[model samples]
Target: MAGVDPDDCCRGAHAAAQRGEFTQATVWDACRTGIRDAIESQLDDEQASPVIIDGLPTIGKTQHATDIAFGLDVPAAILTHRYETRDEHLNLAAEHQKTVAEIPTLDRDCPTRRGDHGSGWAERINDYRSRGASPTYLHYYLQDALPCMQDGDCPYLARWDAVEGADVVIGGPAHAALDRVVDDRVVIFDEDPGTAFRTEFDANQLSTAISTFLRRNDDLPVDNHFGLIGAATNESMDAIRDAIRDELSDNISIASPREAVDDDDGHAEAPTAVLAMLELGGPIIGDTAPAEYDWDDQLREEAGLDYVELPDGSQVVYDHAESRIIIRRPPDLTDSRAVVGLDGTPVEELWRGRLGVDDIESWRILCDDCRARYLRDVIGYTFVQTTSHVKPYSSGEYVNRRADFGLIEAVENRHETAPGVITTKSAAERLFEESPSEPFIDIQRVTNRIADVKHYGALRSSNDFTGTEVGIVLGSPHPGDRPLQITAALEGYTAVRDDEGKGTDLDYGIPDRPFLRHYREHKIAQAVLRFGRTTAATVYIHTGVLPEWLAEMVTAGPETVMIDERSEGQRGVIRALLDEAPGTAAEIAKRERVSIGEKQTRDWLKRLRSEGYVSRDDSQPYTWAADGLADAPHTARVRLPDLE
Candidate 1:
């Protein structure tokens, strides 16, 4: 297995995620042996059993997959040609499929040469009826065996040469990888292990299918597609599921019972006829994962009558609440083909049950002591809500100010890594391996304090920071609820769900609260990686949940460590103290146009006095001034106080 370059590993993972695409072998050089061996075992095994290694990111699973793909060049064919060519071909002409295309070239660290390219691949695949055209049936499915990040690099049918042994195929995520699984081959799942069983249903397509079917003859409620029978909303998925199941059973005769059930017959059951008609419609409109024992499967003569159990232990149904749902049955590991998956986190029992595995192979080789980091610091900051009586603490101007103050205080004492505000694009770019710098921040430069965040942000933009001088990176959870948004990108959530994260059979809206917690885990993890790698990176997290790993790492966990005391607004208040008349807290709040009450201002004034930032003047109602400015307090203003 390849070792991580201490300096590059953190940024490499970030870069890998942030970059335009992942194709370079260099981006996947850091790896773990457990992952490598697991994949190799699956490939070498005669029994095609799936394998999964649960571990964390930055531990080198992607690197191992990349290495295996480039190093081992073997070939296998899922569909083959038969000489009897006349008799009938057991080819897959139609069983429903996703988009996949063949390319003639290879680049970005592929390690095999294409020889003996298979024949007949160029033939059009007849959806489920492909075998109808015998002789050339499925002969085109042959491919050269080379481990690749994507199937694009798999050796193609050069001359239809016979391949030996079990085939190993790889992809960027579980969905992509699952597509290439063929008979008698090991399916290596080193990417997106968390998504092994997520099922995405297309609601829009379901609506269309039901809509078109109801147009001809309505045996049931026609409005809104049989009323609640075909509604596309999350809550309606379960009800619609029952409606469809009952309809299929009512119309038992194979070919749609000759004609539609007469509407005038008052056949009050759901339009079983309409549901059957939908099967003939575009498969795109209504889809499910694990190939349910539905009209579609029966229509194709797939010879299966089973429903996959979902992760929640509930029998698989049209579950509407989850945007992505896992189901009971294991994927078709044709011929017992092996599949290996690796991750840092423990494997879920839901997946284990699906894979027919009882125990998860778990281990780790990373820690604060690992040489890959200089300081494995994990900080937890608890902050009080930064809201005044007038407005909620939202991701707007007020929150930005609160964030700036917290972040400044967190990193103020450290003169190590350069400090600046890092947006998602830059953070992922700086961290993921695939994302490389065009021109980026100078990590070595240290600033006294970061101010004017918007302007500082503009200066660090692409080609904006042209100076050789250093740059800054402001730290913490970003102002908005962005951490959770980025969390969706982690485990194939974005692949199956719509922009709103709704699935065909599920709604992901429930995770909004949990996503906030998950996102904080990432924040703390990133803080440990990007900042703790070189110095004791201090992260001030005001919102979202903290990662359990980091929460336990630090003793004084992050609480409402309000740094509101050292802000420009407070500085303005200090400046207001320069009033020649030496006014009270109400007078100061009025001068600054601040909505913060006089009591809050007076409390701050007193706090500033105790911190030696301001001195009280011998006047009525006792006003404050910058230290040593009591005498000339009326005319001259001094610098804002700094953290000692």
Candidate 2:
């Protein structure tokens, strides 16, 4: 057989890996080509000899660097500032040696004691020994340690020297030391500390550090050395650039923002293209494949659907709109008694009843039986009747029985028998007659239950004793029980409550009266501070669930209208614009609705615009421009002289 080309092998292995079939060896083989490409790109510009591989966290930056170094037959070293002490570097060297030898070794114990072992001097001595004042150290040690090795017994001194002389250094935080090394030596700073340092340090301190370091080091010839700096954080580069500009002035030349690699056409890779390619594939493989199941076919079958497989191997299917499995019905034995008419007629007679006199009761029983049969057959249970026209029970009475039965069991069995049996007046009358003075009567709760019936439509009656409709019918009122009512009250105990439920009505009570008063005053002050001077237009203040004080504040001024808090943050922007100029309430209302009436902008601009204050020229309508106002320069400050 003809020998398989390396590139061909690589491509095959890569494809297999993409399909999740490749072994580790095969993946490495395929990855070599990409690595070779990366290395070649790094080498192409000899003047910028060292290649900096940059990527976000877990984007395979370290692996990519490893591949490039090994594939290109170039030395790669990871530099890090985390190994700050001499001991740290010694430990790192030992770890690196052990790693290269594939030998299992316990991690070096980090010295914690202050007296002897943890002292800087002892660490320096150990550093010297590890860098090979000891005979057991490898020859690569001398080669790696020569450049930074001070002419002393320090272990890492040699290794540091070698690092300074080496073609590449890959590590984090160690980049700060790069300024001491000759510029021509290829110094690759794998990004870490420099990025973090920027956030905490002032710009001037950063500039001074860079200047001092650069001034001490002489530049190596361009052909002899190259500099590469890899950064994971974009902020790092920004900070570095600012520091460099401030420190080095015109001496340092920074490359413009460009993709780290070039494409087939020799143009630099577009930033987006590099990102897309780097993120080409989906999630990493853990020990096992994702917990996914091929439920499409099963789901389709269950839904009474047919699947059609396309030529492209994709499948299309139509599923059943409803369930196919029919429920088993209850036994129709004579002993199982069901109410027939409103007057307790037998179910058997109700089903075969007379024309006019028994029709309504008969139909009601038939409907109830049908619903019960459906529930028993489909849902696998006989529903217990909770309400009936013959023996009408108040919601409270039903609830008490439900409580006696334990809520869960009651919910499982309860059902409405007759639909549309409860009218709005009846519901209201029931509520009004049932201890109106009771603190927790919950009239609103009952009203909501009635509203739910209207919302779902006339397919089911409101007062039926069938579980399906009754469950829904009672849903709105059922939550008004003490437990649920208390929970709701606790949830909404936000220091303000109207005496009457109607928001428009002025009947109000402050449960925590003092706290409410203080809150209102604070809110008014905030509003005043937010809207400085430009008034005459509506300013939306978004304090959710308007406090009575805020309402009073708005009422105090014609220019300020306290609309519903629901219209706050979103509507504030439009309100700010309206405040700038006179606009009809209709226009304001329309604008508010369009913007969802959240007064975020109004909250932002309230301090600048007062309820009646206006700009010097009223010709232009006050439009809230977030960016415009933020960007405007403050040339003069107008203050009342006496107040100042």
Please tell me which predicted candidate would have the highest lDDT against the true structure: 1
Candidate 2 structure quality by residue, lDDT tens digits, 384-420: 2222111112243422211111222212222212121
lDDT of 2 at 80: 36
Per-prediction count of colliding residue pairs? 76, 68
Tens-digit lDDT string for candidate 1 (122-167): 2222211111111112222222322321355234333112222223
* lDDT for position 553 in model 1: 42
Name model 1 segments beyond 4 Å from true: 1-31, 43-49, 73-171, 174-187, 193-205, 213-224, 227-331, 335-337, 350-360, 363-549, 559-603, 612-644
| Number of the predicted model whose TM-score against the real structure is largest | 1
Model 2 worst lDDT run, 10 consecutive residues: 220-229
